[model samples]
Target chain A: MNAATLARTRGSLVGRPRGAGHVLETLAAWALALLWLLPLVYAFWTAFHPTEYSTHFSLSAPWTFDNIVHAWHAAPFARYFVNTVILVTMVLAAQLVLVTLAAYAFARYTFPGRDVAFALVLVQLMIMPDVLIVENYRTISALGLKDTILAIGLPYMASAFGIFLLRQTFKTVPRELDEAARVEGCTPLQTLWKVYVPLARPTYLAYALVSVSYHWNNFLWPLIVTNSVETRPVTVGLQVFSATDQGIDWAIITAATLLSVAPLLLAFLLFQRQFVQSFMRAGIR
Target chain B: MTRSREWLHAWLLLLPACVLLVLFTHFPAVANLWHSFYSTPKGARPARFIGLDNYRALVDDPIFWQALQNNALYALGTIPLSIALALLMAVWVNGRIRGKGFLRLAFFTPTVLPMIAVANIWLFFYTPEYGLIEQVTKGLGFASHNWLGSKSTALACLMVVAVWKEAGFFMIFYVAALQAMSPQLAEAAAIEGASRWYFFRRVTFPLLMPTTLFVLVNAIINAFRLVDHVVVMTRGGPDNATSLLLYYIYEIGFRFWDPAYAAALTMVLLVVLGAVAIAQFVFLERRTHYQ
Candidate 1:
């Protein structure tokens, strides 16, 4: 445990200083946390149990992967998973390259209208591409790129948030590094590649995690743009699968939900600290 | 070696991003306004300038009014509760509580899961009879509640889901802010025989105002951004009870093929977001900080 946590544990164990109120507060906290986690916990329970036991909650219920198998077979989940992975990777790749170059320019170069350009870029922070779906959809259609993975990723390729975060990180890089790289006969782009990019690894990592999780879970734009199984992301897939008029079947629905979110959920569980810290370090609200 | 080279290289580096940003964000924002003044073309007809017609229709549309009111209420319902709950979660997680790790995980798990996926599970939870809540209510000898199906309860049900999805995410910000706080202040307060509640109210809450303001802006934006759960859970059902502004826009733009109307709806949303952004900037500028 961290020293702070160790201190907390010691403080709680030495209960002479803290009174009944502390105990009550701890109980209340745990209760709220449990309430917060109830839905996901219930999903796990329902997913593992048989259809009959989904609602019954019997202690002796037989465990089965039948629901998962059924859920998988019931939808094109394999294709959806592949599509989502491709979509997230494409968006992240484009964002990384575009944001890095843009940030480098803003960080190092004194150019005409630079402040105005940066201000224009920052407009996307408030007016995200998702908000301009109608016009973007029109644009995508005009380009005959509708129902493609590229269309899904295109609008988000130039991410203002990514550029902003990278610019902030790049600005903190000492000027000496750039001068040193330049003295070593490296061009500006090479200096950025060799110096700025390496120094800004942590920011890139944080931004990548944020971007991947975001596009992976992004639904509305993708839902509007892509129609077929070839391009539908997991979120849209899961929505279509669960919103069927086949009536409510908790077991299968939960299994499908779990399947769709399993990769992200597993990653978060394994890298819980990194996931939380990256978000904090990114300063994203 | 010259200043012109620096400018040239900078423009070269910025060109690709600038192109895409203009194509997507900047261009679309302007296009949304421009299109709002035109009529959406039907087959064999062209989009023509129809100034104020779309806005006039919007003024006449009850669904527009309903969605606007619902979105406003949704914002009102989710923002404060989520922020308060987030602060509570952060304080608890930051405290000398047992199972801090588990509590932290529990609170944050929601933040990681996609809203679309979770809405399905919540769809079950709000299912009429065999749902979790229904099971509890039935066990207590009460009527089964069709939380998502009933018009009266649908928006509130969606608000609860939004709050659940948001609070944990907001808690991470609060946690970071809280962890950065000086423990020496708490020790000093204790030495002065200050009550915990008094110390929190007088010292901690004031210290957290900046974080609160930051989180508040985010909460407000999310109140509009996150309509995924509404899509999965209700689809703005029971006669548009759960229709937020974005969802309404989606319906008009995609489902109804009324881009002009959607563009007008989007203008309203953009204006709101712009106002919030400006307000946040002003707030940040004027914020007071106590070490």
Candidate 2:
């Protein structure tokens, strides 16, 4: 459903009375919400304030960008950012192309072994590449692609979730559209590009957001595969930076944490509705 | 197009994804099983087929047992609480609650943040003597306690982080399901003079079963899959109390340089997840008939 329908549904469900119990419920919700936001809020506070004021809350505490500056300079975070950007972009680009073609094949064509192939593909959903880290590392090192951003993104390039979501979306396209496109002398790939792709924009958007966020946040695999600053993504870099003997500088640690997540957090805050809706759309399927 | 041509076209389109999936997903899975029967090759020594020696060792490995038990406890502790909190958050946000936008934003914020980053933030929160929790406890006249260092509270502390990180992500699904619900049921219940709790218990809860099941499967998978916070906050500290299956595998495979043992450990994880997958398929089949 679209935004308007969700809004209408919410509006229709909002006819509760303003009694004492209702007030208490509201208070409880607010309390829980505040509690949920506390760690993040504290991180922001610690990151912006001086180290002395990390655990000391004061309304008039001085705020500065020095922690962020120090955090930026303390590690090769700029390189890490570049590496993360390359990694997520490579993964999303490859996944979109691969998922699109695979989805189109499954959605429109009859082929031998299609069901078996589909089942095999769905195996990734249950047993993800994350769990098979040991063997995948051997394969990656065998290929001599160690300590590269490509190694970080390679296993995840063929995403089962993307393929599944896009396949479902493609199946919803009318056969008439496919026929019309083919009748116009379009090839199978052309039919996919012209007919199906344009209609599944929302699904593409949802899948892209989910994919980007997942790759951007993925740590363990990247941690295992990549070795150098040039290859480490933001998550791994942040880990290495913090896990080093930095002597527990909470300000710089929190600042580095914030810096690593700033891009995604900013994106979420900017597109709050789209972010929530995209996650909902992605998860529902 | 002819049938052969159609098949060829589909194969051509499917070729890339299938190849990659085989190389990465399917191949590694089979290889994990194959390697588990062998021994890890040290320098100047080749791996020899050991025929379940790794499995035998795993049976005798206390760390393996602890990791398994910890994972079970982690899943049992976190799943129900997160699911419950998710339902509560969904109901509150879906209703015409005051500041609905703020509540929704607050709840869903953690979902978007990188778990590693949030785990680092939590690491700070759990630090002794001067951390936020300690500060609050001390301010309230309670003795200071090492939340993450002590064995008894370490896993529980990590579980709290897991719940905090995941409950919001799960809430969105419940919200989607709640919105899809027909308002007529609620209207009918109201006309029947049913209390809100009674109506929720009798009608809303049952209708949300599919969503609950769906979230339950996802939550279960996440419980097994996610060890980021564990790696960040605890590193299975205080005598392996927080070591998860995957984390243990990482230690064996990477830290200790033992691939064969890790493979055997991975087989256990794979088996657990395989069972979950089969259950999901069965539930999904039943759910289709339910609709």
Candidate 3:
């Protein structure tokens, strides 16, 4: 039988009674979902409403843009936004180029020490740059790139996850495509660009989404490597702002928190399905 | 072209990534070990060889032991519950439930927000008297309590936030795996008159083992690696009750300005992760046989 009929049969057989148990299960799911969303909903509630209503949770609280506006002007958030954009873009761009090249080589070529090299690459997956903060800080300082956007993006540029994902995708490409491109006088790079890259577009998209969200939300390394307002991303900036101005205004703090997360949140909402699917695709391997 | 030329081409292509991976990952890892054997240089005083001194300090440090214990507890607290919740979420979303779309959105929404940002919101939620939890419990006639302030609840509070942030991200993987599953299995189970729970326990759960293993490894790594919430929510405070190993490393290396000691602490984290890596490799190797 087809999938739909099979699904219907399974549903009928499994959910045969469709009585209190099903209702309870549904209630439990919705309740969990609501509980899961409470913090964010509370964030939005506190952000848009007046400060008096932050803890009040009144339904008729007055709404205003004052908190977000105050938050935006409170710090050099515009600069923070610019720095974050540059950092995420720089990291993603470098990752794409480097990972594409490395994955291309690993996927299609056989060479000396290739297994060892691949194993070395995979080592980064476990001992991530996040944990190497101390030595990396020293390295960045030694290279005199400390507190720059480049320093923030540098350590993450050669992402093993990206390379691994792309390598897996590239392996699935038929060898005939490579031969055809070569027979047409295309060089290896050209063959990769024309054949492998085009076919692995889904993987590229998935990796890009995962990488962007990761670096966008990344805190500690940027927090460590950057000390200046000129270099601090929104996460660190928000932390500095909130920590210094501790507990004075929940409205403003929540507003700053919302501001830092707004762009990615909006993107996820707009492309919710794609974002979820991309994460699923990225995680499956 | 020729084999030698092809090798040259491949090496050239791998050059950039290899250089970076070594510089940032491998080199620092080795340097962490090398630095851990020495003393941190003071003004006009260079780092001198002090073999095992830092390691000895690590063994004797109360805070180090506390951080290690907290990290272990944090992992134990977060992993199983999040994975269970993720599987339940994936199953529910994959089922023909009403408003599953909205439920999925709600569940996955937390995965997108920055932990630092949400930590602020949760900080508010855990506020002493006026926080949401406080307000609710007060309505239920409970006394006031500081959720994040108390040493007892601080790490547990952080673990809650970690689970909130991670479960949805992991659910996506399970959802993908569940969708890829053949419906015929369920139909076959149903035709055999097996109960839903029995089918799930016997067939569905076993089938999801690979996904579970994958998620478990990621979860374990994340437990060590994720300090954003700890940094934001607690800063390893309430007498270091919330200090994970990496957070302690950050505190020692940067805040305390003792990279050598921090490197020693980092060696401990590296050993934990290395152990995790080997376990994962063995698990994956064994799993391949099943496939």
Top DockQ prediction, candidate number: 3
lDDT of 1 by residue, A126-193 (tens): 88887889999999999999999999999999988888999999999999988998999998889999
lDDT of 3 by residue, B92-166 (tens): 988867999999999999998888999999999998888999999999999888888899999999999999999
Cα lDDT listed for each candidate: 0.88, 0.92, 0.92
Q: Which stretches of candidate 2 lie over 4 Å from their true place?
A: A1-18
Q: What is the DockQ of each candidate?
A: 0.60, 0.68, 0.74
lDDT of 3 by residue, A83-146 (tens): 9999999999999999999999999999999999999999999999999999999899999998
Write one digit per residue (lDDT tens) for candidate 2, span B1-62: 89999999999999999999999998899999999999999899999999989999999999
Please report, as a value between 0 and 1, the fraction of native contacts recovered by candidate 1. 0.73
lDDT of 1 by residue, B1-291 (tens): 799988999999999999999999988889899999999899999999999999999999999999999999999999999999999899888877789999999999888889898888888899898889999999999977788889999999888888898898989999999877766677667667777678779988998888899889878888888788888888899999999999999999989989999999999999999999999888776763323
Write down the TM-score for model 3: 0.98
Q: Which candidate do you rate higher for TM-score, 1 or 2?
A: 2
Greater lDDT among 1 and 2 belongs to 2
- Ranking of candidates on DockQ, top first: 3, 2, 1
Give the alpha carbon lDDT tens digit for every residue of A75-116 in model 2: 999999999999999999999999999999998888899999
Model 1 chain A weakest lDDT span, ten residues long:
A8-17
The lowest-lDDT stretch of 10 consecutive residues in candidate 1 chain B is B282-291
- Clashing pairs counted in every model: 0, 0, 0
Give the lDDT of residue A43 in candidate 3.
93
CA lDDT, candidate 3, residue A179: 98
lDDT of model 1, residue A236? 93
